[model samples]
Target: GAGVSQSPSNKVTEKGKDVELRCDPISGHTALYWYRQRLGQGLEFLIYFQGNSAPDKSGLPSDRFSAERTGESVSTLTIQRTQQEDSAVYLCASSLSPVQPQHFGDGTRLSIL
Candidate 1:
């Protein structure tokens, strides 16, 4: 893709339901990241995948949230048993390297009812 791509720009789910968000990174980007922006809050890093190494999941809020990246091309974020507190804008970004500026997709706005 020319830039980062995310699926289903908006989502609305009942509390306790599960949701999945997808991301497609740029063609040559080696670093992919997932972040969440709660209403009135700043972006919070959720996970990071770099190349073929182990993914960094330290920032994930809980076991309910998980993400996977295949090589460096595409990624998915799954939030299981969602809660009303989980409503937020989930953003995806990709960069060529750790030191480079990341390019972001519009994001999937998750709304838990």
Candidate 2:
């Protein structure tokens, strides 16, 4: 697809388990972002990556959440010791630059048991 892509449309894991979500942004995009959307809530920004380096990660809810990108292509969001509250839809987005309009992916639904 020409738009951002996310893997494992649905993921089910037990509480305290670790999970990894993947994202592939549109080619040539230099800015990538990760967001989490819980039931009835808006998208909560998680991290932002310009190229391969993350410049803003203040939106991460806890230390258990971390994300990294490789070059301007794929990125991965890892959650360690996942908890019940961590269940949500993980969304990925990308733009030509930080100031450009973002294109989003079909989010990954995470269900913690």
Candidate 3:
């Protein structure tokens, strides 16, 4: 029924600040993934969680990025000490797995000021 959704469709923050973005995946989906699409840049995988624990987090750009999911449901991405380079659309998607086509949310557009 319900598709994935992200909060604060747009966010503007100063550099060096901390920001948290939220995502709500479809019901019954067991896998959640986060990705970043920077301006004119290709999509970059951030992290993914299956069930309630994360098994792959290598895509995190640095210590400033972190995320968590609760039992294949809601997820949140947190950025510590935000930087201008981090400004982009943070997208969340969910599916059976990487091989399955994922449904994507409009994403929370973060702009560093």
Candidate 4:
């Protein structure tokens, strides 16, 4: 894929179920970011990984939300014990560096029942 690719464009699960969302960023990009956009709200930064540097997870809402990248390639966001309030579109983006423009994926829309 030329751009970021996210799997399972739409997901519907029970409130307590766990979910893992995958993102494959553009090849050669060193910076990757994950964001969550609630209905009618703007994007909320979730996590960021730049090369081998320590990731900045300051935007994570709780311990239930976690993300990791594999050697500047694929990244995955895992949500444990999902809640209804967690419903949103999970966006993934990548860039050459933190200061560069980002290319975003279509996102995975999650709905918790």
TM-score of each: 0.96, 0.96, 0.93, 0.98
Q: Model 4, stretches more than 4 Å misplaced?
A: none
Model 2, 47-112: lDDT tens digits are: 999975645999999999998888888999999999999999999999999899999999999999
TM-score of 2: 0.96
Candidate 3 per-residue lDDT over residues 2-97, each given as its tens digit: 888999899999999999999998887788899999999999999988775545999999999999887778899999999999999999998876
What are the lDDT figures for the candidates, one per model? 0.94, 0.94, 0.90, 0.97
Candidate 3 at residue 83, lDDT? 94
Question: Where in model 2 is the C-alpha error above 4 Å?
Answer: none
Worst 10 residues of 1 by lDDT: 1-10
lDDT of 1 by residue, 64-92 (tens): 99998888788999999999999999999
**Candidate 4 lDDT (Cα, whole model)?**
0.97
Assess candidate 3 and give its lDDT.
0.90
Compared with the true structure, what per-residue lDDT tens digits does model 4 show for residues 1-113? 49899988999999999999999999999999999999999999999999999999999999999998899999999999999999999999999988999999999999999
- Least well predicted 10-residue stretch by lDDT in candidate 2: 46-55
CA shift of 89, model 3, Å: 0.4
Q: Who wins the lDDT comparison?
A: 4
What lDDT does candidate 2 reach at residue 27? 97
Where does candidate 2 clash, by residue pair? none
